[model samples]
Target: MSIRKRLSPEESRTAALEAARALLIETGPQSVTLKAVAGRIGRTHANLLHHFGSASGLQKALAKDLASSICAKIADAVIASRSGIGTPRDVVDLTFDAFDKEGAGALASWMLLSGNEDALDPIVDAIHDLVVELNEFGSEHLRDSTLALTLMALGDALLGGPLSASLELPRTAARDRAEAMLLGSIDQAGTLAPEG
Candidate 1:
């Protein structure tokens, strides 16, 4: 006797999102299509439409999931950065690592929403909420400074600028250089405290 195969609605939704993510990473968002997602998951286009309504719906869901996942990592890294058990250099390093995972997703999602003002507003608002929550624990001055550095580094790396490659230097070397620069600035500003 031949066996029948079936997937629950939730399972199908999950599988579709997984396929969408794979496609996004493999060929960028331009290649994402409901037909492709369904085919990749051994389902029909009609079945995909039934679950997600439209290609855009699936893409939206994928973007939301990606944002949530990336934010979780950022939260973890931010906690480590706050402990003072590690230096600011360590914070910068972890921020870069977090961007490496979520940067592309955020960029793509923003680009998509930008062309659709209705979607753009809500997504940006959500991101702003996340950012506010994530940095609330740190001093406003330090939080702002850290966010500025993270954004600058992220932009530089994404743009492939000459100095951007420095972000990929050996971890120890990068940390030492960053720490030296940070401490040097503090000393120059007369903000450095004497050894306790």
Candidate 2:
């Protein structure tokens, strides 16, 4: 039998969350269970329970982890776009991918349907904090743009493929629309600025 390397509490928790995230992306949120995570990490269910208390708690921690990392990346993309090193499409793609490929949308819906509504607090709080942080970048319409972008991303994650196919549009139609919205917001912000 192979010996499992010891990990600190923080390291064990992080490893569990990372494994859960991978499982979420690979299978779906429904597979992100304490037993599965523990198995993946070579730990016991009791260990996961020690860290997270329950499956709901584990899911909440995973939500918080995803939100924090996604927001940081998006914030970097937004700042890079402002500095001409990135584009609005980068920000839009990141947002959409977080909801879609990263499985936040599916996980959020699962948590809600499972009646663990409070688990969404981390996601909501992260978005709010991200918006507040982005405001420092000085787009007057940042709040409205963030609101629109988030809803659009979430909706697209849920239905963009089938809906686009039904409408005879490309799968990326929603992403294109989101990019356009960001570009329009940037133009509008520029136009409304007072002359220096």
Question: Each candidate: what lDDT?
Answer: 0.60, 0.94
Worst 10 residues of 2 by lDDT: 134-143
Superposed Cα RMSD, model 1: 5.9
lDDT score, candidate 2? 0.94
List candidate 1 stretches off by more than 4 Å. Answer: 1-4, 84-114, 118-126, 137-139, 142-154, 161-196
Instruction: Give per-residue CA lDDT, model 2, range 39-122, as digits (tens).
Output: 999999999999999999999999999999999999999999989999999999999999999999999999999999797899
lDDT of 1 by residue, 114-193 (tens): 46334333334444655677544333544445446555545543553344355675534434454565455434433433
Candidate closest to the true structure, highest TM-score:
2
**Clash counts for all predictions:** 0, 0
RMSD of each: 5.9, 1.4
> Mind sharing the TM-score for model 2?
0.95
